[model samples]
Target chain A: MTIDASMRDALLGAVPSLRAFAISLSGNVDRADDLVQETLVRALSHIDSFQPGTNLNAWLFTILRNLFHSEYRKRRREVEDADGVYAARLSTQPEQGARLDLEDFKTALARLPPDQREVLLLVGASGFSYEEAAEICQCAVGTIKSRVNRARTRLAQLLAVESVDDLGPDDQTRAALQATG
Target chain B: MAQKRAREVAEDVVPGHVPPAPPRLDRNAQARLGEQLRAMYDDLLQQPIPDRFIDLLKDLDDIEKGKSTGKGTTG
Candidate 1:
């Protein structure tokens, strides 16, 4: 298929999820934006390869995931240093950090290993099935499942979200954030 | 050498203790975590798409008009 109006819209529609997934992987908004931008550029230029009537969102996700890995490889050490600093900052945060704030959620998400975070976001957040996530991630489905399990376990631990009460009243986690301040 | 042999024999005779596993989330905890994950992701999804991206898509039409097919690698 080639670039058409609907296809362009499809690409646009996929951007927010792509950016969210990118942030989950890179843990920095700036780098995540750049990753999404590059994914868009590649997807637009190579629109011919995209099969119409297939899953456009998954295709875009695969593109972004691949780009992230390649770029992540080249900057692994540099990225790890930045992560060390970020982790240190998180360590010093207050105990009430588990109060269901989006910032708290993001901080906990950042602590996850990128692979684990990627699978977690793919399956848990982005609504990809295990098989779809495996395909996007180019791994076995079982790998995706295991990573999701480990990622959630680690994330919950970091957030100190022990029970439903930790999620706050009425099961409204985000609502709790609004209620707090 | 005698002390070392004695220590080795003593250690070798004792059974190793297995460490306890970390507590995994029960179903309720997992469900709540799922809610939190979706909340975080939905929050991002709901945020306004930045102008840079909107403009980039608009500019893509110009680039697409100039090309018959894509070539070369991303910059």
Candidate 2:
């Protein structure tokens, strides 16, 4: 079906966030771009199936996620670099401390199981509610919550975070930790 | 009262009656992790999207129009 102008515009707007999700999911930019391109093509082709005025982002995310599970997951496992190669290749900003911490976090995130990682990105980083994430993942809301909880716990373990107090003197970090804790 | 007291004592003597405390994550550590995750996500978002994607979208649009106009169809 032909994509209308407004739908096309909306799809364009979702690209950046979609790319971010793809990157986090795939851990490789080139692969992520391919996934984004695939998602777009599929989205455009199936535009008619999309119910108008609903949550387009969620719908798009579901499509991308299904594609990841069906195709990308197996291919990614075969060539997955366990040594932080792709993450190291990422461009870093001038703020060395924050950049280093972000790198560490990304490494930790990569270590998580795909299921946990997807939930973490959806509910934690992507700002989707439990219900929304559950819908996207095709699981129960409780499952999403548990996955997020496990993802956080595993990330903390992987990062060797002994205690919240040991996270240094960043108050915002402290507050965020407390909320999660 | 004597029988109730005996049952209470038996319950106390049962093995594995008390549960262990849940492991306490350092709040600061969790917050730091959360903050770092947010930063990473934000950084990912800031990365420039490749031009190929935009070009692909345009191509798809053209293809759709082409189909409607009875031009050579491209999938």
Q: How far off is each candidate at the interface, as Cα RMSD in Å?
A: 8.8, 7.4
Consecutive 10-residue window with the lowest summed lDDT within model 2 chain B: B15-24
- Per-structure clash totals for the candidates: 0, 5
- Candidate 2 chain A, poorest ten consecutive residues by summed lDDT: A172-181
The docking category that best describes candidate 2 is incorrect
lDDT computed for candidate 1: 0.72
lDDT of 1 by residue, B1-75 (tens): 697445434443445622122466665577666777787678678878888898888777667666745564466
Task: Say which docking band candidate 1 falls in.
Answer: incorrect
In model 1, what lDDT does residue A158 have? 86
Show the lowest summed lDDT stretch of 10 residues, model 1 chain B. Answer: B12-21
Tens digit per residue, CA lDDT, model 2, A1-181: 4586677778888888899899898777777888889998898878899888789999999999999888855766787656665445444334476467676778788888778899888877777778888899987665665567667788988888766444466666554433332
Best by DockQ: 2
Worst 10 residues of 1 chain A by lDDT: A172-181
Residue lDDT tens for model 1, A1-181:
6676677777788889998888667666778899999999998878888887788888999999999899978886675556555544433434554543766776787778777788878877787878888789887665565567677778888877676555434434333211211
